[model samples]
Target: MELRQLAVFVAVAEELSFTRAAARLSVVQSAVSAAVRTLERELGAELLIRSTHHVALSDAGRVLLPEARATLAAAQEARHAVEQQRGGLRGTIHLGILQVLRDHPVSAARVIAALHARHPGIAVEPRQAGSAVMADDVRHGRLDAAYLALPSQQAGLTLHGLSEEPMVFVCPPDHPLAGRAALTLADVAGEPFVDTPEHWGTRIFSDLAYSAAGLAREIRYEIGDLGGVAAFVQSGLGVAILPPGMIDPVASVTTVPLTDAPLFRISLAVPAGRPTGAVTRRLVETALELRDRTPTPAG
Candidate 1:
């Protein structure tokens, strides 16, 4: 079947509405319907079952959707490959980085600068985003690569470990436990805590660490980022457990090692099972080189 027909089928399968798919493709509904019909006739299978009130994918459609997407991606990659061969590694890489990792060592800026210096034709657009969302973006081809915590096991993605920073306890300098040599989640079980929202990667690490220690963290305030968390903690609003790299240098806030905290792993992840473009490969190599040069944070 033609790639155009497959594209229409994929659009219809995803939107589940001929009208919506037409709008998405910027074509008329009749053109979309005719394309799907042509694809169905060529494949000798009914891809979708449409009714007056509802439209759903048939078993054949469900089976072909992923294959269709892969085919389309491969075709796009082929075109990109030709363009790169002619122009020498010229393209924009949509990259995502965790907000906290921007200025730290092995930072996104370092990676982008290295890539740019090596290949000025390569354009890098960096966006600060949450790790979970970034992982999904990489998996779906929305992002070429991302610097963030790797998902435990996300399909269609490859994660390369960069560095693992230990989580630490932060409290006001005058707090009773601030002077402790070492602490655990249980040490601050009853203390007010300030941290990011539940969807944050740090929050996931905190939840898992506390659960493992059989202690419940009383998150008194939910801050959007580590800067806000540091502000709240320094103001005596609550204590916080955060990556050592995320700890602020505020004179009034002290960071203590968590004796039983999870390591905040930073990884460079990319979409799996696809030919990575030249610019994206250079970016990944730069990140790996930086990771080698940087030391892991101690607890």
Candidate 2:
């Protein structure tokens, strides 16, 4: 009636002895005997006749042996088919991303291109959102994976952090620090700053950078988009502390390091304990690889 029962029946039928069958099945002989007895009781018939000296199949046992073997084979096949996905050679996968990566641009497009090139049937589903919202998407089934600048460390969540692109100070090209060979946070500490919305991860990075320099950032404007903040700085409105990813090399704006800002890393957020498919795995790898093309710290 059950797969295990069928396996036991086949083993006992082949071995013609419960002891050999239990040893082959790695179970006690009494367990094998009890299983055979249960199988017979379920069928309302005895399938084997055993004595102190010999064991042989009864008429019912002979009738059921072939069917039991066939059933076990079918069960094995079904299990194998169900497990084929684990081999990690195919399948479509979903991916999510923050609306803006700290310093990476169109991060999904690069990952998608790489996944499609290697695996034919694979595709990427991208969701653009803030780090807070994206974190939830990865937790729920809505997203297969995501990129997070800063995310809450929750159970059932996994992270693969790729690189650290710390927040830096930016100003109009005509500003005093813009003409220097290198600049520091102290250079712009006295000026009004374009700051993150003072809510979460991005904000913490900017604040820490200035705090490390022994100065509180003079944030004059607080907005969500770093690119927009850069544009505001380019207008000579004020100098700002911005992440390396947020700047697109706008001609009028110049970016400089904040002396010793805490490294704001970019991490790939995935649901913990869920199996990763081939496409999803490659996409994360591609994102890590992209980091090489970005600026590296001064040696």
Candidate 3:
């Protein structure tokens, strides 16, 4: 029932490995095991199913994981509140940033810079990953907040729209579709496309767009970053549909507007129904303020 025991159990439940959880908590493996055992003894039920090589959460663990996270979050919020009243906020915020947005105006760098200027005591730890991974990290309490490109509604998370731009088609200068003023999904249905992996935010958005139009395109090249996608297109490997500003002008590629393309949106995602600590709240506010001040990139 102790907060320390609950914290240890939650770490093990999330990592699903005693060694890894201990490493994350900066404690020894035996200490982590002892804490989990003490928590199970008090709760009267086994929380984790442990084996020599693997660890899995039992039904009881599954039921307690979310509650444990909420409890820990509440306790942290209480501490942050008292600290804020005393002088200023001081805590580390684990933040996730989408790789595609590394060059964008309202990127993690700008947001972190602004937040730091306001609160010198707060520290931000930025992790770069795809939007889907970032969203899952936020939902599972691995990250305090993340910049994500996702649909309007995601389970167990809240998304705040920051910027939106229409998706555009990019191809080699001599490609057939490059001469067109605009394109529809059907126009590119049979062509080979260069796209990110299926889990990436841009890929997910394009998939939904094609599905809505009852069309499917072949993904010929799978690149992890927008720059690489542009390179593949410039080399005549395949065409791509990406957000504005993603395909640099220096690349010998042509960008054509889509007639009814899906909007590529960037949003701020946080865990739903959880109390926001003072540090996290201030960071969110600063991000929103900066987003409003920055101009939207042209499509």
TM-score of each: 0.81, 0.58, 0.89
lDDT of 3: 0.86
Name the regions of candidate 3 deviating beyond 4 angstroms. 15-20, 23-29, 49-67, 101-103, 295-299
Q: Any runs in candidate 2 off by more than 4 Å, and if so which? A: 1-92, 99-106, 151-156, 180-187, 198-201, 208-215, 273-279, 285-299
How does residue 171 of candidate 1 score in lDDT?
90
Q: What's the lDDT for residue 273 in model 3?
A: 68
Task: Please give the TM-score that candidate 3 achieves against the real structure.
Answer: 0.89
Using lDDT, give the best candidate's number: 3
> Could you tell me which residue pairs clash in candidate 1?
none
lDDT of 1: 0.81
**Which pairs of residues have clashing backbones in candidate 3?**
none
The local distance difference test score of model 2 is: 0.68
TM-score of 1: 0.81
lDDT of 3 by residue, 166-254 (tens): 99988899998889989988888789999998878899899999999888889999999888898999999999999874666578999
Candidate ranking under lDDT, highest first, comes to: 3, 1, 2
Tens-digit lDDT track of model 2 for 1-299: 78888778877876788887887678999989988999999999999899997889999999887677566546644554454556424454666665453435436666677667765556566766666666666664456687776734656678876556656767888887876766666666788887666544577666756666778756788867767777788888887765666565654688776656557766788767445543456677776676556544421
